[model samples]
Target chain A: MSDLVSRHVGPIVLDGGIGGGAMESQIRFTGTAVPLRIEIDFPHRMNESVVQDIDTAIDSTDYTDRLARQTIAAGVHRTGTCAAKPYASWTAARGERPADPTEFAGALTLRRMIIFPDGGRNNPERVAMIYSLPDTSDEHPIEVRFLQPSGPELCPVNVRPRV
Target chain B: MSDYDDLGGLVARMKKAAIDCYMAEDGFNPHWNDNQKYAKWGWAYHHYARPDANGEGGGSPLTATTTLEAQGSVAPRFDEIRSTIDTILTGWDTLPSGALCRAPQSSANAATALLGGAASVATVNDSDEIVRATETAMASLNDLAGSFVGPVYDKYCAQLLTVTQNLGTVYTILEAQYAAQQAMWPAAREDVVAICTSAAAAWEGRAAEIAAGARQDSFTVVAAVAGAVATVATAGVGTAATVGAVGAFASTTVSTLSSLDASGGHVSGDTYAEILASLVGALGALNETIAAQELELNRWLDETLNAMSTQLADYNLDAFTLADFSAGDGSSSINRTDTDMITTAMGRVEGALSEALRAAGAPPVSNPTPRPHAIGVGLAGTHLAASGVYDYANQCLQSTAAEYTRGRGLFDAAVADYFNTDAESQLKVTTLLSQEALIAEMGGRG
Candidate 1:
């Protein structure tokens, strides 16, 4: 019955570099925000691959469900917990894209941020507090802008697997 | 009669003779202008092999050609001639260039049919006048079926080019990353340059030698890819530098492939000689695909395949057509299967060979190499930037892939579109993605 809590981090200036090259570069945060983990939503290679699949789903609901199940089984698991309490849920990847773009929500990465039973002890998610936003659309622009969290409620999200 | 009229009389007599031969032999006669002096029996095998003919078996086609009844010339003689020509050409009735074999000769064949005003050579026997149109169609169909292949090969090749370029990009990016890591140590850009340049040159040098080694036949292709590390190391550069060198070499190879034939030409032991002449064309298409992002291959393939499919779908395989086809004596089919299997097998060999070649070159330096990220004194120091340079250099490979993937896509699409072959497409994409994945893993360890 409580309103969902919203926490903010970042506006950490990214290093002047293009591509994944500057991904590992450190981000300097604002004084109020504790320097948290950098959240990198890497674009998935299959964004376009799934586009066609989604289109096909319009024809057959059962087929779509079957494909969805298959994808989940084949997919990498990402999870997280709320830092204040280890309350967690198995969250699916979500992306915010505008039919036409003009906002931050409109930007996306093929990667996703999922919350699990315990934020994460040992998994794609490193800690209870951090979770990443998955990029699932071609329209999403992948920028490794720094993730700064307010109060420890939000931790650094799992941006990607280590290279 | 005067001598000039006498010549005209001979022309008339010869024209009547060809018509007479067709009617007597096949029970049909094609159209002709008795007034015309030249023998225009391009339909007949005897006519096709006349003196001053192109040895590759294609010749300059005429502006006014007919199918079974083009130009409203549906008489028995015209139909017979059209049918015979269609049988001989296999829906390939034109020769765009008289001197040279066309790139991906199949495409040229289709183009020829189109140019001859046959609406496609399959339409060459659309009348009752030509007794063996069905036979010609059947032979054409068989020829077309033998040429069908999946898109896997194109994808595989694209993957190869993408991975190669990706390696090059990483080396260039990481060299700077590594040198910057030495800020705490305070090293020279020149020394750094020396290390970088030497390594780069060595890798490039090896690749050049290999590329140059592609003599008149039997390209080594990816034979030495895996040994890249050792090759770079011996040139007096460290592991990081060696990466750059190897990257350079890979980039060169990818660049070389961009310009390959886009038309999806078939090559077998028997047709290998023809393929040799088309080597430059195929290379050109590959290069174009490697260099461009948005692909437009579907149209070209559709245009070419549509005609062949239509013609072959309606073929009958008469006596003469059967004879010409059987002359191949199943050698063409044998050659095709052998070549397809060989190419497929070669595809598998590439990854292993590449890995081995690189391993032989450097064999990993004592420990498995790990890519370094950044080792800064804290976030604010310029001198501290040097720590993760090696890591970045290694990581740069992924970035390079990002940049050059567009071209690979285009090339893959073109090949698939040209031949409607998924094998070609799969071949290019998978090979490239795997290379990138392996390199990223290797670099991460370093």
Candidate 2:
């Protein structure tokens, strides 16, 4: 009288993890290999180059879960943006830029950010993901871009099965 | 032709050929060295099923490992082997059937198992156990097929194809060089395999003599035949009953029964186990020979690839293209002579030797070949003698120019054949893999 079961966990996030078992494993197994870094500054945009309309920027999802579902949804959105565009970024971090590649081993990295506005400020936040081992001296940085779409915005779905 | 200016064109062409050979195997040109080529190559990789029909590589040694000079593009095949092994290991952590599915049962679901072992017993009835185990075994076989056929088999095949197709190019160059130096044109690499074959035959013949001696002398086929004749011999059909058979059993002659027993050769049952034990002991020694052959093959690949790389790197490629085709260790081709090319090739060989050593499926290293010639001198002398040969080869090219050339030819021809063979071989392996996958998708054999 035994049977197999599949249960829904929560939205999978790559930004700051929601700290659940499912989120933890996804980060370690799949995320670690993604070769990208993402950080989200809650409420404040990292760069001011892009402008946003405050009237259009409204939070539709509830924060009752303290980011278990919300964080994962954010990660899906960033991963989506990564697939859609070729990234270009100015990496000021040491070991971020290269002088000559032929002499170096190999270098490549991805930096993704989920942005949130700061207190009393209308600026969007940032979440950046960095991936690459030191042995590979390759320096190719792929920047992740996120657009806060208008209307009843949907939280991205985290597809991992919760344990 | 010795000019350096034409190198750019030559390298370009070589690079193109190299890339073409690489792409021919799996249709991805992972330069692995250069970025754009690597990226383009990487883009094509999306966990696609390998083509059906090929098992991946040819049975030829020359076809398997690439010489640095030839740019043998067989690394991917080996890579696939590594990954397949890894995947197989991953699959083993479950109910045998679950492993085939590449799905590990959750540890939390189980009560006491350490690894996330599938509660197969808990899930199914005893009647289905055999079915589940068979499904698991099938998956393991599939993993092996994929690894064996994928990058390892295909890379070797591409290499074989390129080398075989380029024989004409080698012939002309070697002919010109031989005439210039008052030397004979080098023999084909197949020549060496013939040498090895003859050598093997000679050894086997000698071993046969030894085996014959052991069977006749050491085996001691028959010893001290045993039988006895009894006095009270009676002419009767032993214990068989006749018309008046009241005393048929009691009146039977002891000698008659003994004679009947003696008709069949006398041998104790105890001897059978002894004979079997000795035979097993004799055959146990044969296993070492298998290990020895594997080691020899590894050594051949390592030493051969190392030398060819050195030679090719030094060769003048000026006449091949408007551009000088010489490549160095980031060195100038302005003075690229045969020595320089050979030297550069040696560097590549050295690199590959270390790489090959680093490679999996290496034959026995700590175990040296036992020398038959040292029967009188005993174990120590033979060990030294075998070690000496290995030591000489360690510097990369104790094998002379002639040997190197032959070896290179073999390596080239092998890869070319590998390419052609593997194109088909890979297809076959992939088909098997796909079948396995389909079976797995349908919940496997279970």
List the lowest-lDDT window of 10 residues for candidate 2 chain B: B225-234
TM-score of 2: 0.13
Worst 10 residues of 2 chain A by lDDT: A53-62
Off by over 4 Å in 1: A1-163, B1-150, B179-184, B188-341, B344-349, B352-446
Error of 1 at B387 (Å): 10
lDDT digits (tens) for residues B1-446 of candidate 1: 43322333332322233233332222111212221211122111111111111111111222232221222232444344334323322211110111111111222222222112222223122122111222232233234322122212222232333333222222222222222122211111122222222222332332232222111133332223223222212222232232223224334332432333323221112111222222222222222321121111122223222322233211100000110111111111213443344333333333322332232121112211111112112222221222232233223323332322333343334334435544444444444444433433222222
Report per-candidate TM-score of chain A alone.
Answer: 0.16, 0.22
Fraction of native contacts (fnat) of each candidate: 0.00, 0.00
DockQ of each: 0.00, 0.00
Error of 1 at A18 (Å): 72
Our tally of clashes for model 2 stands at 88
Native-structure RMSD, model 1: 43.6
